[model samples]
Target: MQHHRGRTRIVGALSVVVATLAATLVPTVAANAITGADFDPGHIISDLQFYDNAAMSEAEIQSFLEARVAPTGCVTSNCLAAFKMDTFTRAADRNICTEYTGGSQESAARIIYKVQRACGISARVLLVTLQKEQSLLTATAPTSWQMTASMGYGCPDTAPCDAQFYGFYNQVYKAAWQFKRYSTPDPWGTYQPGNRYIQYNPNPDCGGSWVNIRNNATAALYNYTPYQPNAASLANLYGSGGSCGAHGNRNFWTYYHGWFGDPEYGGLPGVTVTRFDVANRYESSTRISQEAFPSAPVPVVYLATGHNYPDALTAGAAAARQGGPLLLIDGASIRPVVDAELKRLRPQRIVVVGGPESVPESVVQALSAYSPSVTRVGGADRYEVSRSLALTMNPQGPVNEVFVATGSNYPDALGAGMAAGYRKVPIVLVPGTDTALDAATADFIRRLAPQKITIVGGPVSVSPGVEAQLKTFAATTRVNGANRYEVSTNLARNLYATQRPTTVYLATGLTYPDALAGSVLAARKSAALLVSHPYCIHPSTLSAITDFKVNSVTLLGGPVSLAANVKYMVRCW
Candidate 1:
């Protein structure tokens, strides 16, 4: 995020000559400074093109000029003549016009007139420094005429052609905001940091050369107001003082004299100074939050699976044994399965990991066979399963933590889950990809040490090496096949339900039908089910659940379906 600028002896020699000439020949125009009335839109455009050929295409420049002349009610001739003469000094000393190089300044003021009009701060303020220090108009000078390069004329060998002007502009903008917070007066218009400006100089105590320039400039511009030094203010605004070094230094008045020589030069009309404040604001805020992470609370996670499939059953059981909630979903049979699990595992929450296609027929028949559980069913719909689960886990309250082990393609859902998990721990991804997990994911998992890891796809999708590594961490991991109902049910029971529930159902066959049969039986028992076959319900079956008042649903791998018995329960009597 930090940019470096180079300074060499050659820039120093140029600085002396430019500064001497600027001091002698640049006659002080009227002290009142040219206002908007004096500028012409046409003139601004012509002059901008005249000084910098690339300026016309810059949107910021166009916008700025258009706004200024729109109100003046003047055409190209009058507007162009007035703006050129007043701002550029009739093109005789075109060097006074400088191009903004910093991404921010360049973005804000593509053209000098645009910058002036938008900021209500003068381009002259920036131009004066460019004229005295870098001779911006001269092609002979290096392209690093930008204020972002470095302090002084000498470009450093490291960043020989970088500009540092935008960096300074960024500092001032931040200072303006901070000042706005504490005081009503617009600091951007008057308050200047002169003391800290001197301190930032590499040789502040050597000869007071920078100080003299600052003082003289302030005197000539704002008549030298009684300004005190505030190092903390500068640091807070510009991020200087400690390890950040000169780039972080906001002690403007002390660091550079080019800013305050003429009030007319300092204030441009079109530029919105606030744009530069974004970088500092974002950095400072993120940094402070990162520092407070260690003291946060911990969160509990629940893993769920489809009914009776040995693999999923094994994974869920392992998770439950590790003190994490493991639930099984089998269509309308989920309640009894949940009840049974509640008695055995006694988890605090429940979560369903598979999709609607996994809903079991026996479970649906069992629901149809019973009246009380049927009444609570509220008609099975894919959305209902997800909604019901959401209500059960959250229960009109905010969830502090959530961990999703779904596929990588579900970025939106993954992001939401990660945000929830962020309250207590960082979001980490276990090795689910065929290739090794990237550094970021590995690092996050290492940091979190989550008690339970959910595998969205079957074990086949997860690298064996990753699974082995996860087992070594002493964390319980649950692997679920691709079933939306199972996924949603498991998540809900673990996160929102009044109490965690678990029930085990044995699948007789390893094929898809057996998995469905087990899921039905588990559902009949009111327990969350975990299955490991592709025979889960179809997407239509899953979508039908949206009509019901069910909870959340998670669809694992693929190939889904709903049997006739399960359809009866999902559709209701």
Candidate 2:
């Protein structure tokens, strides 16, 4: 069955609309950048954004039309602003659509609202479609052809406009009806919400790509237009893209964003965000560990001090290599809850990281009650502990690689931990103040003889002198940013963006417990861990979703770790 897209371009049509807009209307303020790559062929616009009936009231629609043209500008009497028609009532189509009321001597705005109320299609969509099809909204001299083919309802490319559908009320009703009609179970359109090959131009010779259409709104737009803009058209959004360009859907997105706002931004929209949290950070670890090891026996469980986060960074990497969970415990003695969890996990051995000073000898002895074998990997300081764990975790010589970060802070190393945990390697902590890489840290890495070493922060955190020293050990790559936020995004891009993982773990960048625990969970889930401000999500963090093509985010902790408002920001911003 053949159906019509909204309309093909008529020369000087959109230019008139653009000029009218620049002269009278306020310029469009878009929240996100309009780039070709960010264009989700699958999700051009969300269903909620498309079917919103109350998107505009009668007054707002009238105001929009009035602003575009003036009384003196009109060469004819029957302009869109002054157009009036008698609208008939529409019956409900069961689950397909709702009913619309009829009216006599109704204004164009009133007709649009009634039709929208009946069909559940947005008035904004109707308004934009008017201009996109015939420049009806801004034309000073409204031609008979423009008014008759107002919404471009039944005007197929190879045939003349059907006389029966040639009226203001007729076109608006038919267009809105067609949009809702395309959503039915036995929809009468070629395109639909799935993998589809959409053409760049009507001429099949121009070629196209397989687009994963996400919803009815996007599919409806394609069914109406039947073509996507080529790279040349996308490259020149405001103007022309030579002969291959198609402007129907492109103008629809542009007009909506410019006049109203982000088509998908009225509510918390785009992607799904799931939360994984509990009373405290300790539970977050145990829960994730249980998820990773559901219905299976654990070989080992690693313990690190809850008070300090540095040791856990390296310990996490080692624990991951051994298919174990890194549990946080009090420095003086293990918590009763942790002890209880230990009994439940029932590991063959318990490996306690850091020296007795960090985890007292009494605690080590107490751990033995749960597991017959209790091993202690102690070092004089955090740096030493990081090195010790790297070697102990990998009995095999020349492991894949290791991550090196400053011991002074946890942010850089936190990112390093995720990569290491995922790769089942190690993360070594180096003293940032040391002008040269310490012999101890350097020598421990030399023994591992990794193929590569990634420095997690800039010179301030891990100085250039140290980076040079590590190069001697293996091929060296550095992941850094102006602040911790940039480092996290860069690491996420480097690690997981290639495969385009939709799901990722988000933790507050201000602290370490949630991210520390979440890193292992991310590794277990085969995802990346990202950090941001506790309340307002960072710009970089939000933009990363579009750049990386991530459609799902899992926040690791409760409001205590990341505030409730952060959830809203992740989607809207």
Among all candidates shown, the one with the greatest lDDT: 2
What does the lDDT read for residue 190 in candidate 1? 35
Alpha carbon lDDT at 431, candidate 2: 92
Q: Pick the candidate with the highest TM-score.
A: 2
Least accurate 10 contiguous residues by lDDT in model 1: 271-280
Q: Clashes per prediction?
A: 138, 2
For model 2, residues 90-166, the per-residue Cα lDDT tens digits are 78866655776778889988988778777878787898899878778888668888888888888776577777888
Backbone clashes in model 2, listed as residue pairs: 5-224, 42-214
Report the alpha-carbon TM-score of model 2 versus the true structure.
Answer: 0.54
| lDDT (Cα, tens digit) per residue for candidate 1, span 1-573 | 222222321222324333333222322111232222432111111111112221122343334334433444334322311222111111111222223223322332333434333333234333433332333322122342333431232233344443333443432232222222222232332323353223322333421112332322342222111122223323333222232123211222211222222121211122111110111212211221222122322121232334323223222222222224333443454544344333443333333333434544444344332222221212143223333333343344333322434233332122223222212222233335645554545544444455554444345545666566555543544534244334433433443245332322212112332222223223323433333212223333333333222342222211112211121121211
TM-score of the candidate numbered 1? 0.20
lDDT of each: 0.30, 0.76
Candidate 1 segments exceeding 4 Å error: 1-16, 19-110, 138-201, 204-573
Position 80, candidate 1: lDDT: 17
